[model samples]
Target: MKYQVMHDSGPRLRVRAGQWAFTKEEGYGLASLLLDQDFIHDVFTSYRNGSILIYYDGEVENKQRIFDILDGITIDDLFEAEPTQTQVSKEITDDFYWNISGMIGRRLLGKWFLPMPIRNAITLYRAIKYIWNGLDSLTSFRVDVALLDGAAVTGALLQGQYDPASSMMFLLSISDELEHYTVQKAKSTLKDSLALNIDTVWLVDDDGEEKQVPAMDIDKGDRIKVRMGDVVPVDGKVVDGEGMVNEASMTGEPLAVHKTNGKTVHAGTVMEEGNIVVEVYSMNKETRLNKIIDLIENSEDLKAETQGKAERLADSIVPYSFLATALTYLITRNASKALSVLMVDFSCAIKLTTPLSVISAMREASDNRMMVKGGKFLEHYANADTIVFDKTGTLTNATPKVVDVIPMSRRYKRDEILRMAACIEEHFAHSIATSIVNQAAEEGLKHDEDHSEVEYIVAHGIVTEYDGKRAVIGSRHFLFDDEKIKLTKTQEKKIEKEATEHSVVYLAIDGKLEGLICIDDPVREEAKYVIEELKSLGIENVIMLTGDGESGAKAGAKSLGITQYRSQVLPEDKSRIVEELKAEGKTVIMVGDGINDSPALAAADVSVSMKHSSDIAREVADISLLSDDLYDLVTLRKLSVGMLDKINTNYRNILVFNGSLLVLGVMGLIQPATSSMLHNLSTMIFGAMSTKSVLSDRDISNDIEVEAIQVADAS
Candidate 1:
């Protein structure tokens, strides 16, 4: 609420403060009566900036008119006007409100309900005790967030960190036990196609002390210096210097990165850091780390937001004797019986179990060579039915072997022919060029010094004077397009075979086809298994997208069990394909790895980019797999669906527990302390249950008893 003293005479006024929420809600402001309006714009005209306070005039209606501009203000519009305030305020989590409410409830109990001083003291003491109890619960949550990876609730149980809270309790509350079983799914795994070592980076270093022994080691409290064309490594404050940073990674804002002090910098963003110095606000572990991790892991669960209700339920319950209040109330809603049951509705079941279970599952996945950034993603992995794949480095081995090297004339032997080709190719860095170089090296053909003056023509053939023939070697289309080199039947047949196999480039000499080389990039061994497993998990369509020509795309698709293929697509066109699929009512999960694949990756309903992919691609992608294992999708899909079920179950459980406990809370049998314990317990139980789905029932059944014995022995 906003108020101003009429010259600070009648009464003292507090400075107005807008409650921290987005403009989608409303801001605190007092209106003037200039035009019989209750809003701030009755008299004063508003400037483009959103700050309406200092802009107020002496006329009350004028003041209201000026402030009325606020109603037109939204987060999107504000960013356009002010442009710097992109921080959409995050509503404080339930922990804050419920804790304060519990205090208020305690004070009410002591002052109005109790007559005896001793009773009042005891009541007040119980309320004060709950505050510390809440802190401990919060501490446990903090620890879980720090060490946990994968689903928010499932991955937190590795060390039995919250052992007193039954882990399976969450499961019982969150999911109906499954009744079906399955084995080997999908057709086959797609081939691995992630190319290693083909990235360009522009590094931005904070602290400005590169000489200070391992610069990343130094503690940063000062402003970081991120110049133009550099990747911002960590979230920092603009303390010292700045330039325009490309903030497309975080906000999807298509603007020059503006520079100002006190602005937050995110990792994997480019400095476009403009001309200002900002301080380092948070580093690797702190900063907006949790939020970013949440974006990666949480797969749109509408239920998890009820965390506040869980806390309030914890605060509202009364101390009770042996019987569980929540269950008693559900069975019979008597004031005394329900209060006792409400005391047992400790919502810790929701808070503790899910995260712990996910953490454990992620740890397990890691043991099997997968790194999950957070548990929320693991929990949702089971629900993802569509899996898209990038062609180049993800499905096919980046390296291709030269299988057939034919020469037009017997005058040139294979080795000499390859040596000349590799000589010209060495000047270029295209995929085919690298393949030729690698093949020549494999054949032990030494580099010749004579082919020194080589020039690479982008999107065309390489031209070099090898033995002074003005050799032009590239695509047959390149020669045809140049309208220069002609191919004889012998050379034409050879070129046709090479091109048919998807080998790039045609060798031409003295305006005539010389010979052709066939290079084949074989599919990864794991491709077949991954594809089959994904199909089993219910991926409706398995398709391949590539810039590789149709023959090569079809060959890879056929070999890897893909029925649909798009070849020779430009980078922008890949996302377009995904758009088409979405138009057809498909929920696509685009998996890609390349600097060129960023747009397509972002366009997919759920994006999965290999960790080894381009930074831009990874930054834009929804899910970043840290390895080139196609089979990992099985684990991801399994866990994601499982977590969604758990989330669903947990939500139902919260409603059930609260539905039963609310009656008890209204009655005298349920008091604050016991209710808090029960509430936290309920949260913990639900949390544990949310995590158990990380492994299927069969997987768990197969190893439990024996593993339990082993675990006990180890302990």
Candidate 2:
């Protein structure tokens, strides 16, 4: 682990351990290890130079900790090396540079050293492949870019112009290489942003007691518990228990795999049913399940609809280009002029630039803390006219506050009821549960483990065993209608009078009403402004749906300037409403953050999940905002719209510029070689332009800063 300081700045440091200090895999391992530190923001490591450059928090203690961690690295750490997404991107980039250099070297050396006959033979051999591809397209009854390219090269060869023919083929080869490199680089960039953040897991002790602990605290050989609806936190083998685990994240198959004792389970897969205790095999950088290239490959199938249309249009224009070439040859009786006309068709630029635009936009979205699954979702979001929002977590601030606690039964005190609720609720992700836990903490109430085997009923409530009683806490529907818990007239009246406007959580123990907790969810300060901005951006209908009472929903809608809303809606009702909106010919966008929101998410044209969304909701959503700010939604809208605009602009420019080229070529103002070279150069230029970001930093920030200042002043 001996190393020397190469460079040092306030927040950036470079250290080297000499050549061959670690292999390429170990460099990835070192980078992953450094990145896991809370103080480190980014890291770059090179095995050849044996250098690690670290970007980190500027605090004094953080700097010291980085050095200490580096000093402590052991040879054993290298054995557990695994490649990170950053490493994958670096590998692809290196390969691209090397391959491009090698291609150029071969082209130049072949030209300078090889005699005329050998060079001609090589050009003719390459021309045969292009000609065969054109024949294949003809056999399929489709004239495409391949046929046009083939015709251009064949004309040059027939005219005994081997140098021009070879040059054209070389340029085409370079274009194909560039396209492949762009696609692979885009996938690598996207894969880095899709990593799952598992903060905590249930660790099982040697005595078989299960306790929740941070995921980072566990290492190889630790046993952990995985339950229904929970994501497996590490790659491991099941020591005991059984479950149906969903391997969709690892394998694209939709079905869950049945895993029992001695069977293998992977990190990032979710347990759909049953429970299992897993013996940890690998953690962090060594986990095999992190290789998710298949998922990235699958995203190619989710191309934007506009991109598909552009590709089809490019092909459809190919036949017309052939007709133009034939007409020119018949009228002028000049083979060279006809060949020049054929060289300037409009497919290459159209096909290359559209996808590059989408991929670049996606990368920009990722840089702004948003994970977009595919380009089609961006197109859908851009075209969406109506948007539906869930009440608690979407419109209002998700941090609800506990206002009051009323005891229904004389046996339990208010503090006792509050403590009990927090004890069971701490494990759940609902806003109400967080409010109760925060309230208990503020009141200095310590809620230790007093419950056993808590069961979560999605959208309804929680059921658990508390103090030798069946304790149930949730919505009124869950306690009264579903569980058949009776509420006396007097108690009902007391609750109605006390919790008139606030949302109430009913708590029942041993089939008796024990207490009621009142929660008040305040509206987000920026909600009204975001709504106004969305309207300005062409979002016509803004609607809110909630499970709260009508009065609460009405007030929330009024405060947010939303004219349409639905109250007391169940999960199924939310889905039905979205479907009804679609039936009305509106492209709908649904925003939600709970397991109950999954159905509505699937029903909408495009769905977005908040930063703190549940696992199921994130799984169903097309886009997930990693930042907590609601304004990121506005940013997403602008990005999607900007992407569409760029695509259209590219299309228009391609048609006009290529058309001018065609006219000049047919007029005999340019040679066939010049026409071919100019056409390929334009395609490369358009592609390079498409990769530029759609929205500049100033474009995204200026409006946000102004609106935020205005909102603050008004408040």
**Best-matching candidate per lDDT:** 2
lDDT of 2 by residue, 1-715 (tens): 8999988888999999988888887887788888889889888787877888899988889988998998899887774366656667877887788888999999999989999999999999989999999888878877899988888888889988887788888878888888898788777765664566788989999999999998878988999999877878789999998888766556644346889999999887777656899999997756765555355565656788988888898888898999999999999999988888888868888988888888888888988888887789999999999999998888887889999999998999999999999998998767899999999999999978888988877678899999889999998888999999999999989987888688888999999999999888998777787888899999999999998877777878898899999987888899899999999999999999876777788788999999988675676678988887788888889999999999999999999998988898889999888888888888888988998887778767845785667677889
Which residues of candidate 2, in runs, are more than 4 Å off?
1-81, 98-132, 135-142, 162-167, 193-223, 227-229, 234-275, 278-300, 407-429, 444-453, 464-470, 488-494, 509-514, 710-712
User: Which lDDT tens digits does candidate 1 get at residues 1-715?
Assistant: 2322222211121123243322322222222222224322222212222122332234655444444544454445332111101111111112234444665576456557766656534533333333354456566653221111111122112222222122222222222111000000000000011111112222235435522232244246644445444456556777655466656566754244566666677765654323344455555445353355444333333222233343344333322221343455456655444433333433334444444444445555554445443344453344455666878767876667778777777677778778878888876444567889888999899876665466544335677776767788876556766737766687656556656766555677767666677778887666666787689878878778876666777888998899878876666678788888888887788878765566677677667776566555655665667666665666667666655555557657776886555555556456433443466556545554554536655533422343455467559
Best by TM-score: 2
TM-score of 2: 0.84
Model 2 C-alpha lDDT versus the unseen true structure: 0.85
